[model samples]
Target: MKRIITVESVTEGHPDKLADLISDSVLDECLAQDKRSRVACEVMLTKGKVLIAGEITTTAKVNYIEVAKATIREVGYETEDIDFECRIHTQSPDIKHGVDNPLEIRNKENTIEKDIYDMLGAGDQGIVYGYAVNETQNLMPLCVNMANAITERLTFWRKNKTVKGLMPDGKSQVSLSYDGDQLSGIVSIIVSTQHIAETDLNELREQIKSRLINDVFPEYDLSRTEILINTAGSFICGGFDADTGLTGRKTQVDTYGGIARFGGGAFSGKDPSKVDRSGAYMARYIARQVVTKGFAAACEIAISYAIGKAQPTALDVVVFGECKLSVAQIKQYIIENFDLRPAAIIATLDLYNQKYKPTAAGGHFGRPGFFWET
Candidate 1:
């Protein structure tokens, strides 16, 4: 059977991505100052205003407004176009109590467990899924990888002035036809970009086709692929000026791009203590390892947790195409070899010390230099 899969990515100048970037920048600052900081930062953006609000427990002295403004400016937006508001507060004592004294210890069920990994409970209850495939060099789906590459190329062209009058906000989509597990051909490519008022739509399209698309997908045969650029005509107004952006809104773009199942939890602004963020990272790590070790051609794993509990409530895996080991056996191997507790995940990935700002805009899982990606 033939199937079509599509995935999309947005530039840092996109409104929702701007919010994600600002949120993660704050998280990065907090972690830089206090590695033990428990941060859950959120950001919202709209015309002429930016609102920063979240629960945080840290000694880091961050100028929230300045951080937001600087991030916006770095994304090629003018601070003069927006005002900033911050409503940050300390993490709830109730939640902190759970994190400090996990249910496993409080109930005396695991009081004899001497491992420090059992002490930190999951920050929240949620399911996280991780996926990997052999089709892409980075172990990501080809469509999403290509989509993100397109957006990255757009940013490159805009920043380097290779495309005249190109602005920051942009989006890219890739559609691919698959013959069962094997890819057949490219179906179509779509690009929407914001530019200055002086830019001609036809010229911009030619430049993108010649410079951006050709440069990004030189290996693919696009002679039969449909290329759509700025289908809605001019995009003179974009970013926060024309759209409202909220943190965690682009969960699909941040993960497997809908090719694999996701738990619907956003990864931006939240620290690793939040299982929604760390657990997902761990799941991805496991799936990538499974594929890397030749256990499966493709893998997707789910790990679910309960609030205030150190142990995962459930763990499951699904291997696609061919697998050397049964799913049940692989699941057992993971249980024996990996520690799914919140604290263990944190220590294993060294989540606190790493930078998160770079992850805010791009898809998170396949990026190089990230500990989880390794």
Candidate 2:
């Protein structure tokens, strides 16, 4: 039996991504000055306006409007933003107090480092999932890997001027076919791009086919590949001008692209103290470690937490029965080896010092040099 699945990715200039970048840039600004900053910044962008609305508590003095426009400019948006608003304020104290003192635990007995793991509650209450598979070298599904590669290359071409008339606002999607999990072939390549108004569409399509599809989609057989360029006609109406953008809107693109379960949390604009970002990253690290150690061909981990508590409320591991070790034994090994507390996760992944702007754009899990990916 055969199955087909697809995954998608967008460029940094995509509206939602632009919003995410602005939000993360604000977070970066705060973390740069005050490592203990508590932030929940959200950004919205449209036509000639940018609105930054959220809560932030930090000793750092940041210029919110400037931070936002600078982020848009970095993404290659050259529009004149004559109207901007900053509705940011210090984070809610109730939440802060909870995070500062959360220390709930199970059985009241533990061996993990207490200094970092004790008395720290999850920044918020939620479930977060981590997944790893041997389908690709990076433990990511092949279609997602290909989709990201295509979009990333498109951005590189736009920025480097290697591809004529390309703009930063773009997206890529790939359809992959599988025969009982064994790779079969590629079904299609879809590219939507924002480009110069005066460029020739026919010529543009040919250029993209020759440069991007040929270069990036060689991993699978393309003997019957159907390349679709700008299916909705010209994409000159893009960026904030075409739509409004908000932070945390691209979580699917941010993670495994539906190949794995997401815990209904977004990563951007939250400090490492927040389990949404730190916990998710830590979960990825754990999943990858299990796969790298040959404990499983694939692993999926679920972690749940309560507000103002340092200990996980629950831990669930599913290894698809591909391992010799029992799930219970594997769970015990993880308990003894790794720390899931917010502070411990922060320290282990070096989450606070990350250059979040890069992460805001690319798919977060598969990238190398990232502590989670390691």
| Number of the top-ranking candidate, with lDDT as the measure | 1
The digit string of per-residue lDDT tens for model 2 on 45-105 reads 8888888999899999999898987887888887574489899887778887788756553
Tens digit per residue, CA lDDT, model 1, 167-281:
9999999999999888889999999999999998899999899878998889989999999999999999999889999999999999999999998579899998999999999
Each model's lDDT: 0.92, 0.85
Assess candidate 1 and give its lDDT: 0.92
What TM-score against the true fold does each predicted structure earn? 0.98, 0.95
* C-alpha lDDT of candidate 2 relative to the true structure: 0.85
User: Using TM-score as the measure, which candidate wins?
Assistant: 1
